[model samples]
Target: MNFTVVNKNICVDNIRMGDCSSASIFLVGDAETISLSAAFDTPPESLIVGPFVPLASP
Candidate 1:
């Protein structure tokens, strides 16, 4: 199922996520997991996890 909590887009937080006041996005892929916490870390932004992050978006 695709869902979102503090994120704007679709995702599935496998567990009950903590207070996502920070936009620390943890992206998990097949071979690796990349975090966008640098750009999206800490408060008021949003939490987003997905397949790919476009260069434009990053």
Candidate 2:
């Protein structure tokens, strides 16, 4: 799954592993696309983003 920020037009893949004792999952994906789209409204100018490789899910 991925968290895509629309305003910034940026996305990075994410994979969350399951713990031995847990049955419930954390975030499957950034369901709230609207909020996520707005999260990068004020990114720092000095920040340099990158192309990242996501970890494989088990």
Candidate 3:
């Protein structure tokens, strides 16, 4: 999985893995490219993660 910040805002919180809110809002699991938008007055940052490749287990 890969992570990318699409925007920046003071109001926006720091993005990290295992957090569903941001990931669920942006990712749909089947897109080559995606974009994000902020709905609130403060410009919330956008994030994208996908194109995941599982590693081989030993």
Runs in model 1 deviating more than 4 A are 1-14, 27-58
| Candidate 2, position 43, lDDT | 59
Point out the worst 10-residue segment of candidate 1 by lDDT.
Answer: 28-37
lDDT of 2 by residue, 1-58 (tens): 8665655454658755544332333553455433322345565996777875454447
Q: Score each candidate by Cα lDDT.
A: 0.48, 0.51, 0.50
Q: How far is each candidate from the true structure, as Cα RMSD in Å? A: 16.2, 14.6, 18.1
| lDDT per residue (tens digit) for residues 1-58 in model 3 | 8797665444535644443342345442345666766465544465445686553433
Instruction: List, in order, the clash count of every candidate structure.
Output: 1, 0, 0
Q: After superposition, how far is residue 20 of candidate 2 from its true place, in Å?
A: 23
Reference-based TM-score of each model: 0.20, 0.22, 0.21
Using lDDT as the measure, what is the rank order of every candidate, best first? Answer: 2, 3, 1
How many clashes does the backbone of model 1 have?
1
What C-alpha root-mean-square deviation, in Å, does candidate 3 show against the real structure?
Answer: 18.1
Best by TM-score: 2
Error of 2 at 29 (Å): 16
